[model samples]
Target chain A: MSTTLERPALRTSRKVPPSKDSRTLLKSQIRTGWALLAPALLHSGIFIVIPVVAVLVLSLTNYSFGDTWAWVGFGNYADLFGDVDFLASLWHTVLYAIVVIPISMAISLAVALGLNQKIRGLSFFRTAFYIPTVTATVAVATIWLWIYNPGSGLANGFLSLFGFAPNRWLADPATALPSLMVVGIWQGLGTKVIIYLAALQGVSRDLLESSEIDGANRWQKFANVTWPAIGPVQFFVLITSIVGTFQVFDLVYVMTQGGPGSETRVLVMDIYQNAFQDLKLGYASAETVIMMIVIALFIGVGRLLQKADAND
Target chain B: MRRGVGLTLLAAALSVLVSSCGNGVIEKSTDGVPPAEATGTLRVLLPSFPPSTKGKEAFQKVVDDFHKTYPKMKVEPDFATYKNLNEKMSTSIAAGIPYDVMVTGVGWVQPFASKNIFEDLGKYGVTPDVIKEKSTPALIPAVTYDKKLYAYPLIADARAVALRKSAFREAGLDPSKPPKSLAELKVAAEKLTKRDKNGNITRSGFDLASATGFRQSFTTFLASTGTPLYVGGEPNFDNKAGLDTLLWIKSMINNVQPYGQTNAAQQPLVLTGEAAMGIVNGGVDCSADGIGQKNCDDLEFFRFDSGKEIEYVGGDLASIGSRSRHKDAAWGFIQTLTKPTTLDAIAKLNKKIPAYKDASNSPQAKSNPLSQFVADGLVYAVNENEVPSNWLEMRGNFDIQLTQAVLGQKDPAKVLHNLAGQSR
Candidate 1:
């Protein structure tokens, strides 16, 4: 490495740069980049990669939070298929992801479109919508819980003026998931809207002007010009949304604790319950690994969709 | 049910086998020598609060007091919360962290004791006679299995209703009395309930019975109503009181009286005075002096005065672990805390009833509501250890089932029957 650096110094010049020396210099720079990156790589490997691998290994064991964990290969996985609870949780999580990811994307896109118009309060609107993303989960959850309260919650209280009976948004099994989904969408929209807004603003006005001149209506211009440019941004949001929905734990934990007779119970909730409440660490690890795989599949599919759309 | 039977028999057989290895009687210490005052460090572990903090400061203070008398042994205290305390303790013990004393709740005594976590005090020369008069040996049954005493039972925590005296008066009921039976309480609840024109309850007369959601409070009523949760070493929540209790709670929500809104999302209005009365944890919280006193100062206690002699009394019990390295220190702590004088001090200070029979009459201890409640319900206290692995998982299942029942999504009886079958 030192010899390569010396060679770059000795042979390389600015106007007639030595290709060999430049290549050596690049190699030396790359070596230094890796050296600097080692700590981060080591951290991710130890904290993230190693634990993820352990979860896969633990997925085959019999472990609760308190009980002495023991290896029982494929026991947890086998149990997962046979367990009605896990199946329900899996279904709930998938449905939640299916509903939330798309709705959040649409709302985000709408806000992004509005922001792309160069509104007078663009910065204020941007900050206002993005505020929820920065708010604490617990604080946001608490406020939303009040807003969703059946009798006196702000939502029901407002609805009551028109003679609507109080709806137990968080308590009713049917409403609970949707209520949480709304909150999730609300939280995601803040960040998603900003991303799409930036991407939309980056679109060339010349393209839209040309489309308009070619007799394209506002809707046609949007469909033909604006949307195509922001496809990559939409894909970015899509991948994140899909991955996030599968691992929804904190909201469920705080809002319902997977209650109304496990109606709101999701895969992540089951994993946490097994690990902490039931002290079944190994079993939880198995559930976690299953979630990990689901996330990976979602991201994989998301990437494919992005590629296909981009090609189109 | 099969697991329950198998575990019980295995435990019984193990205890018998272990006894056969010894002289059949577990003594305090293995050696024949008497318990002479020896000097060493004795470590005591508990949460920063009860069910360990009860005797902690007192224990340390007394240890200091005792050291002035003996000038020898040292007593050290360890504190953690109930949430992760047990895990920390279990991990520490499993990894040989050398925890000498564990000041834990009494419920854990049997499971860990049967597992031979603590040295049997009886094996070390602690005789039945010493425990009989000194401690509530009645608790030994919960702490012991197959004639081996594992944990030293120290205190009994009881649960009782803390009705607001002012609310009772305003509702045209006697402040001095509570409902004599579950049926009567339902009536009282009706009178206490205040509603808006929109049919929304403004002030709930009583807690939505499912508020506890199948906890010790809910189970206390189950037991009070005579639910046969156990029979002949078999599970027995298949009948009357169990179904009755569940349905009665459902009725309280769906028909007779629905008070405070069930959605906690509705900002629990009681502390804010929206609800009139609630069935609350009768631990120190209900005590006139415990933490809840700040908000519920006007709250007064009444044992569920079951018109019959059968009322339900449930509270936590403190016990020494069988695996404790500081068994002697623990015994000393238990003995001191249970003594009428000290028990009275704690009971009065915390505003709870003392488990010791004598503390009921102690001037300071009896001045509050809990002691009087316990005095009313002494005959009704129940201590059945049916499938007692802390009842935590079962509690979860029951909470969910009960929630469904309260929401009127399922018939209480049917839900309970399913829970009974599933729990077994």
Candidate 2:
């Protein structure tokens, strides 16, 4: 009885003061953790954090990659708001995101569901779907450019087979943005499909079986079990999709160059033109800040939706 | 500990920002030429030479020739393309390592000269009279900014209208007498245009090429009307001539040609037989491998004659950087570049006419009929230079806004007005 009471006291003493070895081990673990993280942390600090800060500082000035620059304190921001070209680019980017995100997400999810089932040539289908993601955007865009050629392209040829008139897919102002959106969707599908495939595979098989036992139909099984289980992944995909569509540059740059009267001029392309072409670095930085904020707001809304979904 | 790390990172970032804010103004050096024995590297930024093995070998010969003059000076070449030339130059300027010499294009002098990036070649005895005596006199205006010669011409890129003799004959027009005026050309084009049963253009009568081509076509037509797009950094086309030119272009779109169509190879539509007639560039190949001699013989080139007969001329120009320590060496290098043998090789490589008085006699010009025609036309060439310093920025805006006007999305008058406003 006395020994047992001593054991309790000893345990209390041990809790009060961790041994020197334990303390050293804890400290060493933290040191190891920080050591492993240092390269990435340093990279982020230098490339991301520093550039963002520099851009913020530049947005307040009239820096045009020249020697002399004067501080204008939000003047660039004011100018950006009034700039018609920039406003159009913003609207184009927003419209692109709105059209691209939901459709791409739905199509990819459907593809992911179909591929998730035990099927023949599963690996081949998976690789085929992921090939576009790995292909260089420039190469893809060039191929698409050929495919959109009015006279000899596959797109028009396919349309001709359907007894439809040949459309100037990228050349017409009416069709240019939509044509780009199609390329954007097709190019983005692979990554989203891969992500959804992974998330779908992670959905609890036991939960799905239980839903089926409860007389749940196919749609009901997906709605109750798979969808809820993949809610976090859905949020992740939404945020990524929003960011990706918002920052689209190379595709449009190669394809149309924001031609046909700036019909396909997206935000990043406008920023690039302002910064590099017009030599208006400060104004471009302000545009970049606005773009970042817009993307953040979209992600925030996505987060809210995910939280509400979780509550439900 | 984390707070300390955060503070350290913040301080580091702020320091970087502060350092970047340092005044990047480079002091112009008017010092006399470096001695022939100077050993430092003489860096050159040029888009004139193709970055290919053959191009490099040809450029190396030029460098070897320069080495004969300055045997000790090492040469560094940055063969950037025209599309990325501005980016490379701006980055170099920001980095405080501006090239010793830069090769740019026509209409680039004013913008770069305004920024004091180029050294006034006047100090080195490059006067308008000297250029007229030694080079194509018309390019003198292109190299002059604020009455100072900022660049020396390297080659001439002239555009002339070409028509297929067969197409002309088929349309019941005289094959020898190509359309000389804009009005005549429009009529000829309408007649030559071929359409399918569904009313889609099977063959464009006049290929404006695409939206990008429209911008150049506008310059070609506007200059023929005795007015340039811009004069001394201001809009010269905001009046009647500009409106008429734009209206003419708008009228042609989807009438004589499709809105934005080009052949599969992106070659001149006339050359590819995609269009009956179009504005052709300085050079064409009539070899067995190219358009072939028989087909080439069936084409005729002509200049636009409205208020004046003129061809749109643009060219690569060599200039010394203001901050160059070896201005003398740079000038010597440019002189060698302008030599007949070197210029001929560069012209051949670039498919341009040598910007010299005797350009028509250059080997490349003598071999290609189209090139020879362009070289002969260089005498009456009018370029898109002598414009405002903001012309480079205006070029892009012109392409987009002009497209809007041509597509009938915006009124032609308002488009010109807005472009004029933007140029300011």
Candidate 3:
């Protein structure tokens, strides 16, 4: 009786707590998250989503330089598939990607491994390797044109010393695409090497030392320990290089224009020439859509392979 | 070579100077009737440059005077580099924005005419009499499409061999008596060429292996051989004349190893003791920025070795755009620019012949040797495959075949057949 008088009478004004409402909570959570992510979503919708949708619509239509539009189903796609020049451009692009992706990755990985040894003048070496990436494509191509010129160019001048007939670097059909690939590999290697170098830092030093203490040879250690550690980085570089190679345009346009006769005419160049020069907007859109699908499928496959390797 | 063309053209051009200097107004009296109204602005576009900066300055003076004569109108000029002019024009026209006037090669006339991209001057006021009054009325047929004249004949240009006079003297060939035929040209080239030990070229007598060099030489050869670029709308490179042209170029490229060498490689070669001769644009005058001009005073020019040359004449021509709202103003501008007084002034400044036969030949045009060379070539020039749409494609194929032939991808006959097939 005395405790009751001291605590006073209990007033029950509040409603009872319900069971955890996951549905309601989820709805609220979604609201909160969407509010936070609205800007990025809006940006994607406006810039990427809208243009992509428009391209799809355009690809199916007879999009002319005319003020009005007339829709034509599958017309442009049919025309593009039939066009020989378009096919040639696509072939060149595929070849460029196939040769460049692996080579560039290997070069970058080699440089990364060497730099990972902590050599003297590491920064200088890094900058020296990366300098080509910073140069404008025009300047690079223009300078290379002179160098690759049949007569009085530095390349020919050097080749003369070896007593070998120096062939045209850009002019010759046999060498144009290969020469561009060399430039592409050089441009890409710097960024990739840096990325691998960063990834190498994350590998635990203790693990490497432990392997060394077990009397494992350097090659064995690298195969077992270093390779596994940088597997993710290698996957990243390979996928990106593939994508970059697929989108090759400026170098082809500036250097050879897919020339010595369609030897260097890459896919993006076809898209540009057809879309702009030829005014086949609908056809160009179809080509773009096809390119996107190809890149996506390839990337998906690349990711699957990475996962399989990890599991192994 | 480039120097020979430069020198000979210079001489031909100067012959006019002594023949035609009027103290006041030198034009022969004509029934000048294109009564132009005095108001509004007119516009013109061009890809090829007029002869000289001096000519441009003179043209401006004439424009100003024309403005004073009819103070209500103003005419403006525009220029575009040759590289992207076609694409630029295409996009502009597609957008329905057209310049009032343009100056381009005759190759462009037919395509635009077919498209009706240009306004019909005949629809406005051009009559048969006006065409008859003009010099080289024969050229009117070249501008005719669907039996109608689409453009006024401007200047005609052709490919000619240019060489350095001093180099000719040095090479022990008489500068005054240069090569009269292609065989003689090769002989001069062999004599003039110098080489280093280990079979390296020190100085090329001429650029032989280049696709452009080969094509120009090919055209000269074809004209001399009496073969047109086409026969009944089909390429005729399989013909005897065409074969000869192709073989001639192929042999030259094979002979001249390590073909290209300097910036002003061809003409400057003759001047700098590097080359004796070169084939280049036929006009006798040097470019204004002076690629081959600093020593151009001693350069020479020559007609291609034909029994009678069927010159490959090319140059800029002006046309009024169909969409132009200022038709009257445009016509007024054309009248002013092509008038005898203004034409004379322009010819004097340009060191080039005016497109107008009498107007260009009047005392002022005769004042310069380069202008006279331009004038001389006008009568004999021929244009076969220079229409815009077809010509662009033709040029691409020509370059391809020429390059393939030079690069040894295919023999001359094969290259010719391939080029001819592309038109279909």
Top TM-score model: 2
Candidate 2 residue-wise lDDT, B28-132, digit = tens:
343464556566778899998899999999999999999998887888999999888876776576565679899998878887787788999998899999888
Best by lDDT: 2
**Cα displacement (Å) at residue A211, model 3:** 4.3
Better of 2 and 3 by DockQ: 2
What's candidate 2's DockQ score?
A: 0.28
Evaluate residue B117 in candidate 1 and report its C-alpha lDDT on the 0 to 100 scale. 50
- Model 3: per-residue Cα lDDT over A49-110, one tens digit each: 65577677778875533333577898887877876567877788778888898898888888
lDDT of 1 by residue, B1-424 (tens): 2122212222322332233345432223312222345555555665423445555665565566445533555666666555554545544443333355564553455444543455566654555555565544444455554466655544445555666677789889996777747788788878888877876666777764344354444565666665535442244665777677766666677343442255443323344355566554323343443335655566666655443334344333344554444566556554554566555555544445555544355554345455555544544555444444433345566677777766777777787676666553
> Model 1: runs farther than 4 Å from truth?
A1-37, A65-69, A82-84, A204-215, B1-155, B162-179, B228-234, B256-350, B354-357, B362-364, B375-379, B410-414, B421-424
* TM-score against native, each model: 0.75, 0.92, 0.75
Supply DockQ values for each candidate.
0.10, 0.28, 0.11
Model 1: fraction of native contacts: 0.13
lDDT per residue for candidate 2 within A34-71, as digits (tens), equals: 99999999999876787679778878887765546799
Off by over 4 Å in 2: A1-33, B1-35, B210-213
Per-model root-mean-square deviation over C-alphas:
9.4, 5.0, 12.0
